[model samples]
Target: MTATQTKKALLNKIECAYMPVSDPGVSAEWYERVLGLKLRSPVKPGSGAIMIMGGGQWLFLLPSPGMTPLTFETTGWAGEGESFEMFPLCFETDDIAALHASLAESGTWTEAAVRDEGGCGLQLDFKDPDGNKYQAWQPPAQKGE
Candidate 1:
């Protein structure tokens, strides 16, 4: 395929993101309870499961050899210092403050308070049982829509 055709043919949408977890059941339960994600399939002890996060996105909770889950982190535009983040699995919401408040009251593990991202969005960092950080983002409302 030519460059233009290839670019056009390429489906840029991300289907699912693979999240390495110590246990699929545990992670799946956490995602469902904390993030309100629906399980797309039933997962067994050694197997993984697909979760629907709405908007054509999915989370694949796969098993990993390491008992410990990796710490998800990110940095600012400078990209020098590291900050806690679930890089591979950032979630979106329409109302960030409500979500943050709900999660805070839900008794889940919230890593930090919500941050105002200027023109980007509102960000709230949280985590699962294995220290895998996740973020909730609410984009700025469009003007004169």
Candidate 2:
């Protein structure tokens, strides 16, 4: 069998995105600021936030109705690779340098950019106020972009 057919057998594209952001607004903003994705559903009156790419992915960021907002605006043990950290939110950006500049100006105290072991991807690390790690990356859309 060809390599292309092998990949088709094993890999499925991400059908949809489901995330629990302590604050939908903050998560939506971060996705925009870093990944350049416009949130499909803004925080409208009596409506929660749902973000969608123009293509096929939709991420629902459900925040508690009355809970205080939380985002990866702070730093601590979250990005330190602690096993207790659990899941980290990973996003893809078309331009990593631009996103990095924006994050630097954001002044929310984010982690430094790191290159992955793989040749093509770059990661900018940060932890939200809730200590949930969020990383933005670029150049690895299809195994090696």
* Best model per lDDT: 1
CA displacement after TM-score superposition, residue 90 of candidate 2 (Å): 2.6
Which stretches in model 2 have alpha-carbon errors above 4 Å?
1-11, 26-30, 54-56, 65-87, 114-120, 128-131, 140-145
Please report, in order, the local distance difference test score of every candidate based on alpha carbons: 0.75, 0.62
* Overall local distance difference test of candidate 1: 0.75
Q: Which residue pairs in candidate 2 collide?
A: 71-128, 71-129, 72-127, 72-128, 73-128
TM-score, cand. 2 vs. native: 0.58
User: Which predicted model would earn the best TM-score?
Assistant: 1
Worst 10 residues of 2 by lDDT: 67-76
User: Alpha-carbon error at 128 in model 2, in Å?
Assistant: 4.7
